[model samples]
Target: MNRHVTTGFLPGSALAGADLALPGVVPLERRRLQCYLALLFSDMAALFSGFAAAGWLYLGPDGLAQGSHLAQLLLPIFLTVALYNGTYSLHSLEHALSGAIRAQIALGLAASAVLFIAFYTKSSASFSRVLFSGGIILSSLMLAILRAQMRSFVRWRCGGRIIHEIVICDGGVPIVLPGARVIDAAAHAITPALDDPVSLHRIGVLLRGVDRVTISCHPSRQRAWATILKGANIDGEVVDDAVARLGAQGARIVSGHGLLRVSVGPLGLRARALKRAFDLIFASCALIALAPLLLAVALAIRIEDRGPVLFVQRRVGRGNRFFDMIKFRSMTQSLSDPHGHRSTLQGDPRVTRVGNWIRRTSIDELPQLVNVLKGEMSIVGPRPHALGSQAGNKLFWEVDERYLIRHALKPGLTGLAQVRGLRGTTLHEDDLVQRLGADLEYLDGWSIWRDLAIIAATARVLVHPRAY
Candidate 1:
């Protein structure tokens, strides 16, 4: 499942230092997804096997009914617990024992929850005591063995294959490492020409083939370096501490490379799945429930303004990717600034008669449920900004160095900042800062229930003064 490569760099090559770093990619999603799905299937198989074994060992055919009851009630909960604990993350799978423990805990917790509910509801007699107890014990032992074997497979295949890379500045000091391997049997690097923006295609081709690319930049060439980083559609690690300047922490040390990537927040595998599921369920239901309301809003906008009903604009999202966010047109199309360099005032002349009401009631934002379904935005997250969004005289990113941190998660239809009264137009530096603070707060402490709470709280402030 991994690439086999012949080492390219020579032993005498000057590849060392903290200043030499690799540009990153989103990582091997196809591989990761395969691994994740395999683990999930493995768990299911083990659960079933254990249950089947226990049923036969306990009370014959009647015990089979007991196993079914427990499995039907507990599987979803167990999966959810595993998701919350990052048990299925590609990053976490390196240590298989931890994953197994989390899995075991998930099963135990689900079993316990069911046990409590069954007892409290006066339904304990419905479950076979022998089957329940035996199933749990057998499942735990089998899962632990499976996990250990999986880890052994990974260790046997990859443990010797990862390389300890050293990226050093040309003519700078070189350090020595004890267990560092100069060559990797499992992975390869592709360093393309970085002379100009014209070389972007060559870089992109190389990036598609490799996990990492070492980028070396002098302190004086920050602008050129940033330009290169911006133009390339890859995760970048700066040799300089610029990422540290931008509020990213070292996630982990990989293969003895001390360099840490600059990231706004931890990218989660489970969070992506959970959020997508939540958004699909929530958006689909809300769309169905509010069909008439959506239709009415569209008809009103079209009739009142004699213009297109929907307003669409490009907004920056996670990892600086841009997507068109849709809304009911709430302003005079001819006069409205789509790039939004200037903040909207409460009584702006650009606001149309229908626009005012829709904007105030947040009916204009209802169309973004499609964006949520499209996977461009979440039901709850930091609201995205237009390309030229400004706070006072400065660009939004210029207002706060941490402004880009908001892009770490998907932009939302409604966010913590909005419900907390930091919505409307950003008229001052403090406005964006406060909203940023709220967004950061949400990011730092995110959960499925937290998102639900935000969604619920959002209904209470749907018609706030700051909304316009």
Candidate 2:
């Protein structure tokens, strides 16, 4: 069961790797753009040809000239209305009848607008009303036929629908979707976890570039899956008939199953762009400003134990993926806990004099600015933790299921938990609970102003007592 059951995935597919293999499905967004352009071009051609043919048959060259003018005027207006009425949307791409009807409505509106303008401008005599009406009817028929043919084109081009959908079966009733990639979660050991990097990474790989994700999981695991999906930044749905009984807010009935819409991306495209730009600009400036200090620390670390000046440890980052986090080495090379299996206690023998001072002042973490520049971390978000990080006698995720939700955003150098003085090791379950609460809170209604406030607040805690 090392490899989960995957349908539609072909050998040598572009998205395949040693860990997971996916079908060479074109991205849904790109597919939709292609469909929209096809429809637009076809519609333009149909409109012009239908009107020109009618005009040439009715009043010769004079009518042909008038029809060309009419089509030019109608095209822009029709396109505008069609865009608003879902004529060129995903629903339209999926349902030919619905899209065709919407297209007719848009065309009707554009014709009415053209007639209204002609009447008001005393230009009604410029073209024969009967010929114009005839042209509209002919165009309507052509457009309808064109839309019907589009169904065949879409079936050929997109395999029917212009979206990528996946279904995950996790200890629940197995179901089928006509064209969706289905995965058996248990076969892959893909559980929703905050600290289990393997599980998170596997899940992330499974979901990359998916537009819609539907989960069928046991009732006990629904909440955990919901949290994971929220951080995944996709359209997430959970199948459960009892959602109505529980009063799920975003629930809907799809194909006879009750689907609870658990999450859309936490940040929209514009917001993510703004945040990334902020991180890059600031991280680059900080690195340049502190270059001399960074060199001094690195040189000192090398002089101490003659070990590598930087400690590179694998930590869970955004989307629950692992990344090598950089930090100035603070402990003896032999004693460093790469997996963070052990907490550093006060007066620990492994801490050298320089290591102790840098750890106290939080200077050892300065190298993580490089991680920020590399886009592996953020300046303000929930901090990433080592895979084996734990609280009390259990892993951090084992102590609290909601611990994973914080990972929806990039791991930050200083986060809400750090600003709130929750930087120490999770010695007990309650310690994790307190920090988890802060991390979850920070995920809500994120804004640039809030990030700046957190960054300002973080300065106060740089020399906090818990830095050990």
Candidate 3:
């Protein structure tokens, strides 16, 4: 039986992509940001007020001291931690209950820290336990109240609509979500093209200015546009009816047709910030530590052929943006082909003597740490590919949709595929598929530990025969 489906995505994912929106409203992102900031201040005030009230009730009129301390130390800690945890990100706090829970978690963590600090300072006697307990309860309650009242005002300000959702569906049926707007685009026509400049340009234009969700019923279309959507941190959804058909690829399924909206980018808010922070710190340290080695390599390349020591080329990256990737010049400067044809064979004649040693030892790649520092690349992710890079005559993206999915993340200095010996030529279809699979796996299951593991594996791969 030939079955037709809206998208090959999970049924859960289809409805999960639905969002509420109003016509003529400010771009959705800006609205959300404003709401987040408003609520952040409200939360801070609510916490402070709660503490002050508790102090007055339990510790006489002088309870403002503890409230002052909490405002100074604990409040900042809670807000900072919450920012990374994504509790308040992506408008997840629109729901009063969700907002309340997130507030409680942040406050609870901060309150616990205060308890420990009091014990450590041997000042538990100075801190009023009754007021402290009361403050926690009161703060949580007030924030929940503030969120509920604010949601109404926010919705009113966002166009006075109770249900503001945008949907893309294949059926002749009504928009599944109540009071949602649907944009009709046939599933087949929405197939995403990788290198087709016209299509890429059109998609970007069409999806721009849409602060709310830009949805589609084609999974490949969603995947191809994934980079743009992720890069902008805007919303894009895959709508499908077949529960059995949707392979999450790397996306997590959080609900059954009612899942929370998830970022197409694999890493969550906090992890991403930490990863970028780590990249900056690590890249800075490496550049400082390897200054001598980098200089020596540059000198060697110059002394050998009197050519440019660095080889920079256009490479596709996160959100499909192109950047100049820098590497040590490893091929003979005269024979260097930006549009490469010769494979890195066991003994390629095009490789200069100095180039061969640098390429083999992975010293040629040291310059990319600068890209990491510049925010063009990451320390770990799918390695970026040259625009027309191919296996035989077929490009990597030409092979399958999965290859394009790798761009959902920023390209990396080292990747899971390279560490797994999938570097060099893409001999056949499986080569691209497996390599894409590894990249997807890394994105889906990423953690600090996994990143560390990839880094360790990268070190081993540098000396491996496959690296050449």
Candidate 4:
């Protein structure tokens, strides 16, 4: 039986030659950004409310005039110092709760110190150091407490909400769905053949198959279930009811069904055009500026081994078209045991010393700049997979048809997947799954800023050890 899973929002139309049902996971960075924004808005509101209350209570009487003047003078400066000291920009604030608190404290101390220095320098006669000190302490405490409380509240509220739609295939156990009643005996049934499509479909037809199921387990499991549902072309909501019901007890089941009605459509041409323009402009400038280094790398490759410096391999590109991808060769000439066609694994004997260096630093990818110039690729999009890579096969056959959405845009020289440690050899199914998920995510959330960020991250990772 063919079974697939998916989570979160489904696309409007399926891409040709791609799986229409494989579940794709949302990237951590995107999720963190959303959570951070929610926290920020809530915290800002809380801060203003606290300030209003404090003003009404402490400054409404004798302190009103002096306090107003002091606040006007100090607030901006304090905020600036706090931001600097805290490293409290929108970027850094995406970390976990404890990290945020530690940052806030550091910011608070620096802000307070800056205010103290400023007041001393000005020799402000009307300013009371005690009042200023008290305000800083109180403000810091309020901000920290409010942020923490809001974070907890948001998590709790979301815990009960359906954040994703998951479909279960390969009947392992009955999935429980939030707000769903499982009165039928089928709710508790487990089919060993749930992974198989024919058997699962038979079960679905027999039970007039359920529309939604819930499983109380780890968040990772929810993600897995969503993937399975997506692959099966069945869409249903994933709720936290299982978690709520299980709550440190035995495992709990929610509800899920075979009925999934969701649209998977291609991105509009306008977005496609915008991304293309961005790619041409940036790729052109980068290639021109790095010409000297690229030449040197080519020369090194040739000198080390008397083989083609540039390697051209067939890769699946936009619209499932075959394209010869260009890259610096990092492998020695070799014969395949089974066949000549195979992926290079880590520590492969075919890798030369220079090849290893180029691969690790991603210098081998430099020639793809020419591909970008020719309009075969973008500066940031999904990295094109080799035609025969295991990752490509799984994505094509096992995932949803919309999984090809990543190919809607031109293949990129550097992509969200590569920058997030999804590059290199795929020795595990999870690796390919993760890389494809990042690729789809890039397509869904494509933007100029995001492309730039990926490029920056790619540069950073190239210098790091794990990139190899």
After superposition, the stretches of candidate 2 with alpha carbons farther than 4 Å from their true spots are: 1-18, 25-162, 186-196, 244-249
Clashes of 4: 64
lDDT string, candidate 4, 1-468, tens digits: 111322111122112213222233222233433554565555444334444445545656565455455555555554455445543343344344653565466546655665677778986555665555555555566667766665564454333322333333332345554544433323433232322322233323322222334333344444433333333322233434443422222232323432222212234333555776777788789889999999898888889887778887655465334466888888775532111135676777987888888887888888898898788777877787653455443433344434544544668888888788777766666777788788878766556778778888887777545444
Total clashing residue pairs per candidate? 6, 0, 9, 64
Best by TM-score: 3
Give one digit per residue, the lDDT tens place, for model 1 in 1-468.
001101211112212211222343223544556667778878877787777779878878877776766766777887888888777864556566678878998888878988898889999897787788888888888888777767655544344322222232322123233442222211333222232111222233333323333344455543333433333323444445455543434434444544435432333556667888999999999999999999998898888888898887766665444567889998887877665556778898988988899888989899999999988888999898765676666666666655655666789998889888888777688888998899878878688988999999999999998877
Model 1 segments beyond 4 Å from truth? 1-34, 50-216, 219-248, 251-257, 264-267
Off by over 4 Å in 3: 1-45, 56-89, 92-130, 133-191, 194-198, 201-235, 238-263
What local lDDT score does residue 106 receive in model 2, on the 0 to 100 scale?
A: 93
TM-score of each predicted structure versus truth: 0.65, 0.68, 0.69, 0.43
Give all candidate RMSDs, comma-separated: 10.5, 8.3, 8.6, 14.1
Best by lDDT: 2
Arrange candidates by TM-score, highest first: which order? 3, 2, 1, 4
lDDT of each structure? 0.65, 0.81, 0.66, 0.53
- Better lDDT candidate (1, 4): 1
In model 1, the Cα lDDT at residue 372 comes to 92
Model 4 residue 232 distance off true place after TM-score fit, in angstroms = 20
Error of 4 at 194 (Å): 21
lDDT of 2 by residue, 194-298 (tens): 444565677778787688889999988887788788777678888886665434448777667778887777775446778989999999999999999999988
